[model samples]
Target: MDKRKKTSQMQERAMKTMPLGVNSNGRYWGKKVTPYFQRGKGAYVWDVDGNQYIDYRLAFGPVILGYAYDEVDEKVISAIRDGVTPGITSQLELEAAEKIVELCPATEKVRLVNGGSDATQHALRVARAYTGKEKIIKFEGGYHGSYDYVLFSTYAPPSTYGNSRSPITVPASSGIPSALGDLIITLPFNNLEILEATLKRCGNEVAAIITEPMLGNFGCADPLPGFMDGVRRLCDEYGIVWILDEVKTGFRIAKGGAQEKYGYQPDITTYAKALGNGYPVAAYGGKAKIMDIVGQGVTQGGTYAGNAVAAAAAKATLEIMSTQNVHGYIDAMGSRLQNGLRAIFKKAGIPCLLSSMPAIFSVSFGIESNLDAREWAKADASIYKKIAARAFEKGILIDEDPREPFCMSYSHTEKDIDDTLEIFDEIVRTL
Candidate 1:
């Protein structure tokens, strides 16, 4: 009997009902490689086959404190005891919103949502309503959500995105209407000259410029020194709303997210992932002037937007973040792991670029610099995929896709980092 016999059998059974035997397309890595996790704890997970792994993916950056963190889970359970959603707002919801307003420098008012997609979708709608414009500008690799308006140019080859000066809008999904693409202007990130030119031409017609502070979905590429400031200035000059999408970088990067770390404020911001420590909770808010438009002819509401469970989870998570040195500890862990990996890759004679912050970063092989998604795409992703696959087999888990980043949790220790480096060195030696 194979060690993965149960996992393989479960996949076969799941394929009978679900598409590709997984709920999310990214979860499918083919029948042979895809794993089914039974449970998770601090910094680790166990597959259905009973194989243990040191998990670095962290469920795509949600389990910031660690999986099943007691502080957050206890709050959630207490809220559940009170009831989940009682058809109206609760005290827990208010506390969560208040915490967000207190921590996030740009967020004066907030509206909780079910997930990242909901937060980004409503942020765009508020921008349109506030500016009285229909068109929006998103970067080539920026992925706001699954919404039709934002599902353009993400995960597509750089060659298909047309010229850098005037890029093409390529739809990421089939069901999204073609007309929605017309409203979106996709531009190459980190190119301030092109952005300035585009804004000069038709910035008035554009309602909002939604962007991730860093290319979270594209190998965690950081913004150039002056690029973010340039965007803020351009948006202000053109009277266009600047929306910072911090779904991945929100709580993981810092207490106040990228806006705090970067020292520039946007008109609006979206947050999720680490807000609830793995619970489905999200929010979008910014200047009071912009968020106030929500009730005035601009609609944004959901039945489960600020439900008790989500609210309690967020409140607890934020409270812990405010009181403790969560970021400090995680930063140390991240720095250690990143330095170890860098040394290992160097010793193996592999040239790699490690991008973004210590908490959430990416490794791009055979590339010296990754300024934007196009440059990031030029890296040898096949090698990364192979490394990730091999790492999984050796009881280490990382995202196989090169675009996704390696997420670190507060639970990760120095021992974990040392062990990971040892395994990576062994794997790199073979390569």
Candidate 2:
């Protein structure tokens, strides 16, 4: 358990080269842990000090096939040998795009990017151009990514969020200009009344309304019956573009993403995280009319966009996941964990809610097994944190941040879930 050497080396070397010792907050992974990932395979990873742990973070909703998947590694390495950035064109990019469009009907036209924030930012720009409007509408508990526009109202605790009907546009972090709030209007999620009223008030000024179709931010809130239909109808009525931000829910939920799972289509959709099987790549696309703005003058290009490595990785990732049985296998694995955890807590007399889709699952304390956003707002973070800490010490790693949901990946076997549940049961019994 002595992480001194690894943590020290990271502090001395890694921090000097990178800001805050990492590129993303997910890497920080929260709470007294200095992440110096040395290696990962299947469902396990080892820190620099050789401390091994089962990885439930799964790179924050990516790594669907687990870390360093054999097929993905071979594909990416093979592509590198062909040439890192052949620049002009590669069959890999075309293959990835075509597969994405075929899989997710909501994404009629796709454009590659290097990260989620960039994909989201450019999607907004395209929406703005196509609609000739100014404002963007986002939900209270949705997390799109780290862009000025999408940063507002992502898990801004109930204190600052105000009444759910008239939520405040609180930025996720400092350094964001206050003016960004003016461009974003925050709305309560899982409630159609407020969304309808808000759209009626300023639907004219709003160019696009973006949402996490499955609500990945606050432990996954299912859209109530007709909520999605109402939003889609209103968007059509007012000509407001509806965007489903699937950066987290993309490949995790189902093959066709949330749009398919929920039986609705968005004007625009953005994807990242699992798309490249842990490699850094993302994309945004939708109706051809809206995407056309990207080419005209909206400036949606990245030097690393569709680079050889990411493109090849994505192509291979999609092919593997797109298999007829892969989704079924993933759903089975996730369901096993979800049900096992629920049963474990139930038997332990611990009231807990299990929220999950096909490939992802989360646990919250002090909430019923049937979870909702409002109930999730009342969860005991300290309990989950204590549980996560205990699990980590037992070599089962979960997200240390109180805000993050416990995400399950496709690579985790039923045995992993059984062991996780055993440790969890022991931890909760002590609580």
Candidate 3:
């Protein structure tokens, strides 16, 4: 133990009934670390132990405008004062959806949901209903959400997964019924030939081809030239819906998202994370032709879908993102952080490399470089564990899962970047 985590009497007292002494396992920092967030501000987080760290996780991408942003807080507070969950729709919902459609040119219609999972799950349902098919083609590592069909595969390659070319599917978590494995056709990342082949064989049964546009969960893998175009063609050739799971990369990648960045649009796109800052909100819809299915009782509704609080927060977030070059800031910050990490590896005599896409970045502990999910899975996850453990020893919070990409937020300043990089440099040298 680092001798810093002395549990408060309140914490000990609460643990008697609360499972794991906390609500979420993800929020728990480490064995020696229990991340009891006291407060957060401007790319930094404070734990129950009172240790402040420059937070690279960015509250798992929801804090895009940064923690406790004054403007956002004002909006949220205003909503809170008005009432967190109003019985009816707030004007903020209209404003937010309009902003999303405006930013995402492909979006002609939008339906708000609670979170990324809600957006993605509903997107799949809409696709299936629109196209009258049940199957979906999800990449080996691309994670959408906790829904059944999606849960069977999220960042699973190597280990239990066999044969990269025709990769086998594995369950991300236990509760996901094993039968879901059969419904999903898991494809290898960046392999257009195999992807095309798989779709050709089962395109008719497939309702939608859901992808992260840029295989985000697989170390921020950029799409190969014309790769997504090929995907679009296959979908069109078979009347399949091509839904972009931009829950992670949507607003963060660009104002129009990967579609704008890559110059190819999907039939539908899901939005969350950056959509609501830290509030609970998500949306999915595009090509009114397909979205029409949702209206005819194909179904998409939630008690909290357009709840007032989420609507207000999303509206405020969109307004801020639209008014400024938020994408530019994200791009620069990610580049700087990527370069800084690479410099540390070089100076430490470790042949490590960092891969990125503006806001999302990954540090490979073993491999010098890699192209896709299969390659990333082979990199040294154990080495990442070492680095993560050491970083936590100091006051830094990186995403603990090496397979998952770390992010850059607009809130992270030059000083925060410099200090974090310095710590990484020292840690790598010691390793």
Question: Per-prediction RMSD in angstroms?
Answer: 0.8, 2.1, 2.0
Q: Which stretches of candidate 1 lie over 4 Å from their true place?
A: none
Off by over 4 Å in 2: 1-5, 12-19, 29-32, 369-375
lDDT of 2 by residue, 1-431 (tens): 56547666676676778777787766665434656778999889997778888888887878888888889999999888988776576788889999999989777899989998888888888888888998998877788877777787675675678777677788988889998789999887767788888988998999998887766767767777788898899899999999888898887777778887777888999999989889988999998888877778777777788988999988898888777466787788778778877887888877777676747767777866323345577887787788887787788878877556666666788788788778877887887
Candidate 3: where are CA atoms >4 Å away? 1-3, 7-18, 155-157
Candidate 1 lDDT over residue span 1-431, tens digit each? 68798999999999999999999998988877799989999999999999999999999999999989999999899889988989888989999999999999989999999999999999999999999998999998888987788988897888798889878899998899998887989999999999899988898899999999899999887889999989999998988999999999998899999988878799999999999999999999999988987888889889898999899999999999999999999999999999999998988889988998999999999899988878887899999989999999999999888899999999998999999999999999998
Per-model clash counts, in order, read 0, 1, 0
Query: How well does model 3 score by local distance difference test?
Result: 0.80
Q: In terms of lDDT, which candidate is strongest?
A: 1
With candidate 1 superimposed using the best TM-score fit, by how many Å does residue 342's alpha carbon deviate from the native?
A: 0.7
Residue pairs with backbone atoms closer than 3 Å in model 1 (clashes): none
Superposed by TM-score, candidate 1 places the C-alpha of residue 205 at a distance from the truth, in angstroms, of 0.6
